[model samples]
Target chain A: MAYEQSVYLTGDHELVEEFGLLCYQAGYRVTGTAHPGPVRRKLPVFFRKSTLVPRSATVAMELTNVRTDLKRKNLKFLDGALPKGALLLSSSVTVAAHEQASWIAHPERLIGIAALPTFGGRKLIEMAPAPQTGKDALARSQAFFTRLNKEVAVIQDRVGMVLPRMVCMVINEACFAAGENVATPADIDTAMKLGTNYPSGPIEWANAIGFHQVTAVLEALYRDLGEERYRIAPLLRHFAGGNRWWET
Target chain B: MGTGIAYAAALASMDALLYDVTAEALERGFGKLRADIRQSVEKGKLSPERSEEILSRIRTTGALADLAPCGAVIEAIVEDLAVKQELFRTLSGICASDAILATNTSSLSVTAIASGVSSPERVVGMHFFNPAHIMKLVEIVEGHQTSPDALAAARGLAEAMGKKPVMAKDTPGFIVNRVARPFYGEALRLLGEGVTTAEEIDRIARLEGNFKMGPFELMDLIGIDINFAVTKSMYEQTFGEPRYRPHIIQQQMVHAGLLGRKTKRGFYSYPP
Candidate 1:
């Protein structure tokens, strides 16, 4: 009998683990954890280079780390391990999926998923395809996510995508205000919720997403776009560096 | 000018005293308050007996001296710095020393407003949004000389009025207006760059950002002229920071008298 098809999930990021569990629960055979190195060579022979490329096997990677130096290196390492013709869905919050895929051998199979790791179970997801990404690759990505019950928004390839880019800027501005003592963090949060009817205050939202994560995206944008608006606030850097200075 | 504050206080079951320059103005404000309460009763939002009791707690007068017996006196007058300074100066002498003197100014410096008074420490910014009885936010602004007691009292009063109070420094634009600049600025940039149309951007923003309204749609509801004015002041106050800079498109819209729903013409026109 032909082996039941399954996906090989591999990555060391929190998002990788979250996505793996999500796929498993949805009844897609998933193998691997947040760190898949231990089982790297022990994968079922079905997912290896055999005469048949398991039609249902897909590789999902987490490129959540915003540091381009580290992100590029990790993605390059993953590239050598990527099985030929396996649709690759990579996560990149501040780097364009196209840029990440450019260095890969099968660029046509790479699709980028942009959504906060904290927002699991969220109905909406943003997908960006590289220039070389094929129609079949894009369609397969959409079908994979739709089965997981996510509504995807296919947008132009861009750093930070839409929501993360906008949300990070909002949080960065709030940090500047907070650093200046213009308002207490609690009040800053309340003002946003009450004034703009935002789901939550920017400060509180930052805490939820982690200031480290927010600064990562901002710094990446500032580096990539070189815009003064994307500059990271000094206070955020200080807090992110200390990690223990502020309450989450 | 103090009508909205008094209306909110009265609705919260406090004995609110409303004052203005003339009895006609006071009567007009009181008339509006009555109509609002009657609407609430008609909509089944409030019982008639409760509405009448709320209205009974409100008193109207033209004399500033009539505020002498109040625990807190809030000013919601014209946006002139000098006029507000002059009023705070006089109220500092009449109201009891412990009475919390508050200004509902949206953009003026609270520290500057408090400077002219002897008890600057008692002066605080109790900014309430338009249709104060309905909107829930009341920014409790602490001027440079604002005493801890004054901050506590302002926060207490905000809570008493059933409003959520966020403590802010006496900085220009405070929190909401300052932090929310990009919501408009970036949207304008995208529109100006021909990065999709306003309607498409709005649709994407609602779908992706989960906002109740799109940026352009909210700007229209808020009145483009009013939104532009705030953006202009924030840019000016920030010493030409590029982040707060208002787009020329917004400026041109204001110049063309397309001031949104108020003028029936803005980024998008409304039928008369």
Candidate 2:
């Protein structure tokens, strides 16, 4: 939502790099990088909740898949003084716009968006407006993104809206099979594409969407929906913690 | 299914003996083969002489004993573990000792099916997708007791029949079925929860993800009953792993006789 300040993302330095490149391709100015994310390739010493909204951002885009992080950190920071109607477009993958609205003071300004890295470059973007989300806020947000050349579809507010939930859950199942050695990841990907006409293999999707974000979706779904179906696979959690993906 | 396999074999210049349990079943298989060959000839994909030659190379039989001379026997029968195992056991007894006993099962465990067969080492899974001669993918699965020679033989046959062969272990759902579960499972879950309409999900799936069909659309195309059965089979086989759980909506759809395009109703209705 905040086009003025640089968009915040989740991945380490690589995530920052990819997001920056993608932003540039979309004709947005790649401003300056914020803090370089934590370095990996070794055991994590501690868990971190990502820092929240920047003070000066006119549009605060919450681009995270984890609801807990979105609550305790990001939206939590926008408390009391959120610059009077500063548009907050939270990622609606794990939590619905209506639910995320409950956490903020002015629920009218917040809109839910279903976005994932794997969903990049699509002409349409799915958005869910909280019942309290102001009509002006929705129109302005649409106009802003439309100027950026992306069309938005407004769907009913629900957890994991549509695309993100479906795609990420598919990736999670692929990880279960790969972890169990049911088949090699490459073979699993190949079979799905050739056998079922999948646009892309789930393993390849995991890499594109980032394992950590995928795990975040499962975690949030499990916490909110309370079903074993949303439980994260151990292998996927390991990859997320390590910022690793299955090798092609 | 056997008719497709026989068509694929004969098309590959290999002699094929199509077997079934009854004269009526054999006639149905023969009818499909004739229609397929006729279509190919009409499309100019095959010359009349060549189509006749391919047809001549495929012989039909009602008795398992007639397959004794074949080097391989692919069973594309029912999906029940018990039924598949029983059929394989009969074929194992009737076919030659070295014959590759392959099951074209999509959901049953190749290992469990092989467990009851004679010379289990010779049993492998040659999982060809529907319309075997058309779909290019063939999963060559190795059961726990399947020998390397049998695996290689199945793989070799798949390649010779112009299908891409991928190897998998004797796991529930194997490769494609297991990996592809979420496409339908998650869609069904969303639908059951009234998160979005089936048409909306299919549109987003195609437009956003570039998938050819959305989970709901694909499920409708693949009978809701068939897709539901695969999910339930994987769930039970995996000891009720939540990820593979079948949704109540699909079960209800099956009960209502809204199978899919075949039944004129499913996730979406098909006009008769």
Candidate 3:
């Protein structure tokens, strides 16, 4: 596939760094430095503003922003930068399906993809279409991730996408098990890791991905879905609210 | 009853007195424990020396009075409530004053058992899962009048035995059994609605939901009768909460005695 340019809008240092590397390997012209001032950048191109991208660019990649205050402003910038025929892929941790759908000027051009910045080996992208999203836009979005050799799962748009939603529930259950004293944190982790063959224990995984991100997904589900099963454990809420893990 | 409990108690290094109404029951329990220990040693999970030491600490007797000196007695006998209460009353008089009476009842109410004894304050529920040496969870249930010191002692013993102790307030099914009901109930609901086949549901739960096993398969492994009984208990405890209600399909299977792998038929049929 031939493309004029690929723009990435993200504040996550890990994704920014990893995508910079991915762009280099894929031989695509990458624009946009996270910072306003340049500091020995290695990508083919860098721009501080989203509007600086040329009209010929066919793809725009967006990653999650964890900071609560900057999300709306970042989404506005993303909305303005998307070209008429361009495909918009969001890998946001905090962005919900409704919010993503609403942010696109041409909702038919938007597609949601879930990726964990920490695991850069391969990404799990879940495509969600807004009510106005055209089939052509969805196919182009799917093709883009396919070209990158990324795994994809098409799911209904709720929040946290698929893998993150499922994993968050597992982590929530683990925390509830710990809080109720069903098992020690270590033994529960050990049992799940050994007995169940999970890639990692829920607690350790939460710590690596940041507990706040897990809590955000859970709370969003609880709010959007209005189901008791989605209720966040009290201990998770406590930890996410600034109580240290050891303190609990 | 005696075999699983005796092996668990022995493996925990507790000096256990295995009592039975007859000598045959005592002998059977002891024989099973010895065989289990030998198997563990063969598997390299238990050393031969440690297995012998554990077996030597277990004393088998036919007399109820033989348990008089023990600090805690766990009755892993039949699930009949009347029989358990009668046993508790007898042990209350024979055991020492400070000895904490514990029941290994998994389904019955802990409070009901404690009611049978005169000094109910000393009674606690120490529920260990099957093959207790391996499964790590131990629900430490506190009856209405169970003393703080008694609960503490049970928790301390569980910790010493390398088991994780969780305290439950004498509720039906405790934590794991109660919280885990939806795992089975929801899967059955999906099956009944014709949303997916049993195998597909199992695969989706494992691959998509990340569960170790699907509800139907786990129920089959645990036996349909046992799973149905648990569902009934939770439903009755909660006064027929729709969430924990038993499915009709499960009742039909149990009525037919197609109780999973044990009877070679359940959600799926198996060879005897």
Using TM-score, give the best candidate's number.
2
RMSD of each: 4.5, 5.0, 6.4
lDDT of 2 by residue, A1-248 (tens): 33444333332333334444555454443432223333334212222123543455455565655435534355656544456767777777777788779887788998987766646577677888999999999997897567546777778887777888888887888888888888888998989999999888888887777777787777777877888788777778878887455565
TM-score of chain A of 2: 0.75
Comparing 1 and 3 on lDDT, the stronger one? 1
Tens-digit lDDT string for candidate 2 (B1-272): 99998988888999999988889999988998899899989999999999999999899998889999999999998778788888888888888888899999998888899886768999999999988878889999999999999999999988988889999999988988888888888888777887778888888888878888888778888899899889898899888888888889899999999988889887777887
TM-score of chain B of 3: 0.95
Q: List pairs with backbone clashes in candidate 1.
A: none
Q: What lDDT does candidate 2 reach at residue B1?
A: 90
Tens-digit per-residue lDDT, B118-176, candidate 3: 88988999888777767676778888899999999898887877787767767667655
lDDT of 3 by residue, A37-71 (tens): 11234333433334365565677666654554455
Which model scores highest in lDDT? Answer: 2
Candidate 2 residue spans exceeding 4 A from truth: A1-60, A66-86, A103-105, A243-248
Ranked candidates (lDDT, high to low): 2, 1, 3
Clashes of each: 0, 2, 3
What lDDT is reached at residue A15 by model 1? Answer: 51
Model 3 chain B: which ten-residue window has the lowest total lDDT? B201-210
